[model samples]
Target: PFTLRDKGMKHMVGKNWRDLFDLVIVQAGKPNFFTDRRKPFRKLDEKGSLQWDKINQLEKGKIYKEGNLFDFLRLTGWRGSKVLYFGDHLYSDLADLMLRHGWRTGAIVPELETEIRIINTEQYMHSLTWQQALTGLLERMQMYQDAESKQVLLEWMKERQEIRSLTKNLFNPQFGSIFRTFHNPTYFSRRLVRFSDIYMASISCLLNYDVNFTFYPRRTPLQHEAPLWMDQLCTGCMKTPFLEEMVHIR
Candidate 1:
């Protein structure tokens, strides 16, 4: 019942990924295994035949299939509530683990490059100015509330709309950022908020940091974080995420 996605699991990335695992479960039926009733855990032979007698008996160096989560926890002397799983899928990997096992999760996203590059550059500053200017015009309309002011508001609105359109298209012709759809976020990013604790462009980014050190996300104003003071990214810009200001938002 082993699903061979590539040239066997051992040959994947020079054994670095799989070498760290104390137990290897192949074709464990994943999301269904987490959602549905428990299944029998059986050991697989080299020819891919199951040993009926080896059911529920796990060893460090052995390969297993069709395993139950309960069997895994029992053998490891652990609980489902005490696990943190890293995965690449939203529904299949992160969602199932969060809903069923209550595991903390992290997502790997490589598609963030095109969007991040545009946001990090000076061209993004031009975009910011247009946004702030539009905000200021709206504020003036609210304060004045006269017939002459309304005429002025109409003129400014048309000019600002064109600038907003230009700024958005500066990043991409089709979609600006996969994480956002104008003011509201895209469905892909919404899933990240509900399930993932943190996301990174790649797992290799962790190698540069100390494993023993702790990471505390900086307090961004109006982002559910209350701190002593606010650091201004711009005179009138929306509060930026700490990492976004550093141009390394993962």
Candidate 2:
């Protein structure tokens, strides 16, 4: 039930604009849309009747003509260094704007390929290293346990403690630098585990700030959870004699 007229007309008029600009173009032949086919430009009247026949030739001040954006800019006498061209397709609009016309182009990829690759690569390397180290450590612990070797166990524990201390020392400065560079405490805290050991203290010490004071005690593994309704309860009930005694005992 569909025809070329229906599909073609819908494609041409589907774009919604805020307001009419200096020129309104329709049925613009975008070459990238087709790989091998070359469709010629057609100028049509209000009734969609062919008014002019220029095929691939460009005409000034006319609609649906085969023309480059550079030619249009030249004709309009727009001279400025602040021109910015934005496009979703990098190879088509952005490439032509930047390489051929020397215009500043911003390419927007819905999912940035470079960023994805970087993140994936980092994760892959880190995971492989961590998994190998953990597996080796587990194997050594099992060997010591089966052999009933207390000296071996003690030596292993000492080595682990030394490694942990060295890791903490190295990572703390890098963690602080990450926080300082990003300037966002919450984001740093959330992604802290992914960073190297040197950055661990930056995440741990983030709660030192007044805004983050409440989160510090919560991070402690031994900290107990307060009752759900503790805040909503009366202050007198919160500070009851039995509660004060229990707190003092602890």
Candidate 3:
């Protein structure tokens, strides 16, 4: 599921585009592209610059505009999970393709590149380390009802809140990362998981692997199944579960 804009693409328009896929559709407005069956298909000129007459049949080496999915399936006989569609817009481009048509969806999340870079920074790692320490101290505070211990717990809680804000600000000063808001997944992240079979920074990432390569989704640890930070600390692994979660997100 590669985009036309990928610079590293081996097959491109006016190059080896014919060898790339069985059919190519441009300006096929979607989710309507999949939902609307009555929209007539139009032809694109040889240079792929201007629209021509209405087309009844699809042909290789030729470009088309605003084609319906009904005719596309009937003509090409491509349907279900075999058809892997790639798009940037989650709802507009991919939701209907996956949910309605049963096509495997690949989401092009360009923000992934920047988010990964920020996650790898020393500042982000340091904040996570301190946050884990504060969490452990706060858990122990429940056993202490003394005034002095309560005062110390309050101070630690304030510091923990500051660390949380700082960690969020590392990715963004406003909304934070699209994948997360603090430790929880953002609304966008939830939708991304629902709509897409897989996601990457760019469609060009497909070049890094073989065509037949199978990508298996990792089984995320449930809340009840998650090991405590104290257990991980005793095992000498200071890394947070969120770090491991991030690796599996893509």
The numbered model that scores best in lDDT is 3
lDDT of 3 by residue, 1-250 (tens): 1244323344344556456766667778777777788887777665555565757678885667787888898878889988888899998989988887899999999999999999988888777867766676577455898999889889978998999999999888988898999879999999999999999999889999999999998666564465454423421123334333434322
Error of 1 at 183 (Å): 2.2
- The 10 consecutive residues of candidate 2 with the worst lDDT sum are 193-202
- Predictions in order: lDDT: 0.67, 0.41, 0.77
True-structure lDDT of candidate 2? 0.41
lDDT for 173 (candidate 2): 39
Model 2: per-residue Cα lDDT at residue 150: 64
Q: Which lDDT value does model 3 have at 109?
A: 97
List model 2 lDDT by residue over 187-219, tens digit each: 534333222111211222434567523322223
Model 3 RMSD, rounded to 1 decimal: 6.7
Best by TM-score: 3
Q: Flag clash pairs in model 1.
A: none
Q: What is the C-alpha RMSD of each candidate to the true structure, in Å?
A: 6.2, 18.5, 6.7
TM-score of each: 0.72, 0.31, 0.78
What's the TM for model 1? 0.72
Model 3 quality (TM-score): 0.78
